[model samples]
Target: MADRDFLLWPFLETRHRDWAEEVEAWAAANAARLSEGDTDEAVRNLTRAMGEAGLLRMAVPESGRLDVRSLCIARETLARHSGLADFAFAMAGLGTGSVTLFGDPALREAWLPAARAGTSLAAFALSEPEAGSDVAALSTTATRESDGHWRIDGSKTWISNGGIAATYAVFARTGEAPGARGLTAFLVPAGTPGLTIAERIEVSAPHPLATLRFEGVRVPDAHRLGAPGEGFKVAMATLDVFRATVGAAALGFARHALDLTVARASGRQLFGGPLFDQQMTQAAIAESAVDVETSALLVYRAAWLKDSGAPRVSREASMAKLHATEAAQRVADRCVQIHGGHGVVRDHPAEKLYREVRALRVYEGASEVQRIIIARAERARAEEAARCKPTP
Candidate 1:
């Protein structure tokens, strides 16, 4: 099992610790079942199960204020037992994040409760075929109709929970201004006449993903999230809250990798002695442990900052995501090396973790993107400091 001592860190509270323990128990008990079926069926079942257990309540907070630390705790704990479980839980929060943060009462009333209860699924549709990191380049358009409704036309790719989601928060250009200023978010229910799941994407680590096509899909003005020309703000704000939790999920994968490594090294024999007796093996273990601890520190620091009411934890969150994901990849790699032939075999713990940890670095603002964000933030801070300095 992963280390439990991190729960005692000052970054958490009594309630967070309790939450971690509860999720840990639930995940441990359901670990086997989570990996049992096709990806789509497994995710649907997992969401329902987590909902019934009231675990999804954390994803959709009652007070409409997300407790970032609790989110980190839940993702980290759930991820340790099953990557699929973590994916299901994370999507529940992310898919509904725009609505939870900026939806009108009617939108929230329609989506949040059912999402929180796991009775329905939600998705955030932002990236298009041409727009991934370049949010300003999105080509999907939403035109205002004379009947006080919006007619949306475009396509979204790489959307999590794409085909299965009951509702989607779709971002489209409304031509209110230009570039990012013209974008707007809308709440579109599934089975809309012109909306279709164009393709189901398969990945190294399987999860529910699809390319969604929208052709003249229409919704009332009430379906809009936030205000006109505010979709960029809404999407960024939602991502800002979730970026740190991505690091927390990576930390979970790293911790699990470490646990598997330790167990393998301690029991496996090599050169007439336990593998743990080898100096090189011990060194690898030591380094992997350090990676795990450091990742936890960064993840929790970002989470704590957000929970403490920091207006924006962009720099901290980027640091956490960048470091933890990159570090987790290293840790998982070392784990596979330490396991020798057993590591690469299909369905092995090491093989699964290797695939699982890789995608973290690429998604949710990739490692390269995180570095760019950090650099820009630092530059801005330096510029502000220079502006405030005395004339001396």
Candidate 2:
């Protein structure tokens, strides 16, 4: 069973606690079946199941308001049971996040309901083969046509829910301004005239990733998200809301590792005693506990700040992602060490966790990128504070 104590923290309200409990119950019952067999089919089935349970509705709230805490709780709880299930749920929010935040009523009516219903899968297409973190360097171009449509030309790689997504929120260079300012987001429905699945990307922990090619795929002007030259802002705003939940997912993985470690240590016998009897084993478990709690605090702090209406939380969110992902990696490593050869064996709980915990540190901004974001934000804050100091 997953840890429920974290939900009692002051960062969460009563409603958040109740929602966490409900999600945990549902995930426990469904995660295993949703996780079985072929990866692609499992993800597709899980997507529909999550929608049927009304969990996907939380991603697009009634008033079109996004509650960051709810997202964090959902990801954390779902991740504790199945990483693939959590990925499906996260993409549902992330893929259509721009529409929820910036799309017009028509776009929302067209996509959001289908996404929430699991009738149509959604994907966010921003990263390209050459441009991953450098949003300004994206070469995907969307040229305005004489017919009041936009013709997109370029390829996007590493797209989540890639081939199966019903629609993609794609970013492209419109040349409306310069660099990042020139980019714009467009809603590209699957099976469009010139769109193709370029290649399927299989990773260590896979859940439907692919490279997409757009050879003059034209979309109606009505499909554009937000104003022209505002794609960067739209993407950032959406990421800012969901990034903290990435940390929550990491926290869940770490907690699961710790639980497995405890069981292994208590039940295994060595030298006429339990494996946990050794001081070294006890110290390792202690460190794992500290790491788990620390990660939880950071994750919830960012989530609470976002929920409380903070305009910008790049620094907090970066810190949370950086610390939680790194800490979870450490916790998983320690659990593997404790499990010895069994940890290295495939299909073992610890072994599976070892692979699942890796991508979090790299995606959603690498650990190095998060450090840069935090340092830059701190330096700016310090400079502002220095400027306001009165001279004696």
Candidate 3:
């Protein structure tokens, strides 16, 4: 019943709206049931349930297919209610995203259905302690043996769904070469010999985040995501898709904040009248509404470009993620300010939103990274245009 029509605009179809509403209803009824007393356990349970309900189907497209719009819509709805809900939905997509884009049939058949059924959980293993954003700094190494097995060593930290994932699409250095060129990806199962959980990281908002140490673990060559040194490409491609959805999540938080602020302001009285009558309060409402609309436009525009068959939405996705996240932080701050006293208190939507929006800006390429990406993309476009001159 909470109106998210503002986010739909021309970017969505009736089908998308219907799907979003259906998922939202499912989440409301089932999320509480899925909460397993502990936060991390709850997320794992939600993943299985979401898969069984067929929600994880959108995570992987049906052969040579991609539904970027569906992914964004699902994320938007999930984040609007609970951050954990959004995490459950996103992991379903990203945990196996590398495989979805590039896996062989055996790989796909073996993993896709389990992920869809929520019987198994998936994870992306790219981030390392040294490689927070500069992925070239990854220390994990994968050396190929004469028997066609790959030995994986080193560790990964700050990994989402880390310890809980039944399977991990892992990236590691393949040689002594520098930068991202030496990297490769492999499918490392949870029970793989010499692999163990290093530590469980306790974040502000509890999720199943951890550090994984892979010591002399062997994975078959068939487990590779792509060819040797394609790990960077795999990692970048995955981030490109997920980064935009980070904006969608931000859009959800903003939508919720705006709703809360509007409700609070309309009823709270001042000067022998409702707060809505005050010029200052009216301006605040106008500003928040504008922020929400502008962010939605950017978020869905990126989704449309990818769904329309445009290859690699780096520029648009970066722009969307940057603007939507920064905008959501602003909107949440304004909501807190508008509420005066109750804003900072926990369980109040605004208070939780404030914490929820913080990680969005920091992770998946920070706002600063997005600005750099946008500028570099523009520079590339200008260079391409100059090369194709009229020859006057």
Candidate 4:
């Protein structure tokens, strides 16, 4: 089993600790079935099961106040058990985050409950073919009609939970300003008059992902997530809230990889003795252990800061995501190495983890993007410190 010592850390409260154990128990009990069937079926089943277990409720809290620590705990625990399970839970929270944070009462009432129950799936439709990393480059347009409705046109790609989601929080250009300032967010339901699934994307690690097209799709004014031209704000705010949890997910994957590595090394025979007898094997395990612990520190630090009400956790969140994802990749590589031939065989846990841990580095802000955010934040902080130098 993965280590439970982190639950006792000061970063978590009693309730969070208890919640972590609860999720852990649930995940352990359901591990055998989480990856069953094809990707689409697995995700659907996982969502319903998680909802029935009351775990998905944490993703869409009733209090309208997101507890980042709780989110991180859930992601870490779920991810440790199954990557697809983590994906299912994270997308549900992220897809509706804009509505949860900024939607009017009617919109929230219409969406949050169903999402919390997992009876309906949700998608965050932000990226476009040309706007993957750069939000400002988004080309999707949502033109307002004279009758207080909006006509959405264009497409979104790389959308998680795309084809199967019951609703999507789609970002588009409303021409309120220019670049990122002119964006707007909308809640478009599946089976809308003009929304179509353009393509299904197959990835190394299977999950429900698709490219979507919207041609003259009309949504009522009530479905607008925030005020017009505030789409950028809504999208960024949602990502800021969810980014640290990405790191927590990476932490889970890394921890599980380390566990597998240790187990493999302790049992396998090498050079007429246990593989753990080799200094090289021991060294790899030691490095992975360090990576796992350090990743936990960064991930929870960001989560704790957010839960404690830091106005924006961009810097901390980016740092956590960058370090933990990169660290997890390294740890997974070592895990495969320690497992030797068994690691590369199809369906092996180490091989599956190698594939699963890879995408975390790319999504939720790539490591390169996280570095840029961190550097810019640091530069701004330094400039502010210098400006306040007591007039000396």
On residues 1-392, what C-alpha lDDT tens digit does candidate 1 reach at each position? 67889889998899998898889889999855866789888988899899989999989876788888889999998888899999999999999989999998877887799899988998989998899988999999999999999999999999999999999999999988889999999999998889999999999999899999999999999999999999999999999999999999999999999999999999999999999999999999999999989999999999999989999999999999999999999999999999999999998999999999999998888899999999999999999999999997
Give the per-residue lDDT digits (tens) of candidate 4, residues 190-250: 9899999999999999989999999999999999988999999999899999999999999
How far is 16's C-alpha from truth in model 2 (Å)? 0.4
Where does candidate 2 stray beyond 4 Å? none
* lDDT per residue (tens digit) for residues 228-247 in model 3: 88899998888878888999
TM-score per candidate, chains pooled? 0.99, 0.98, 0.95, 0.99
Error of 3 at 156 (Å): 0.8
Candidate 2 clash pair list: none
Candidate 2 per-residue lDDT over residues 258-344, each given as its tens digit: 999898999989899999999999999999999989998998999899889999999999999999999999989988998999999
Question: lDDT values of the candidates?
Answer: 0.92, 0.91, 0.87, 0.92
Better of 1 and 3 by lDDT: 1
Model 1, residue 265: displacement in angstroms? 0.9
Q: Which residues of candidate 3, in runs, are more than 4 Å off?
A: 6-8, 32-36
Model 4 TM-score on a 0 to 1 scale: 0.99
Alpha-carbon shift of residue 32 in model 1 (angstroms): 3.0
Ranking by lDDT: 1, 4, 2, 3
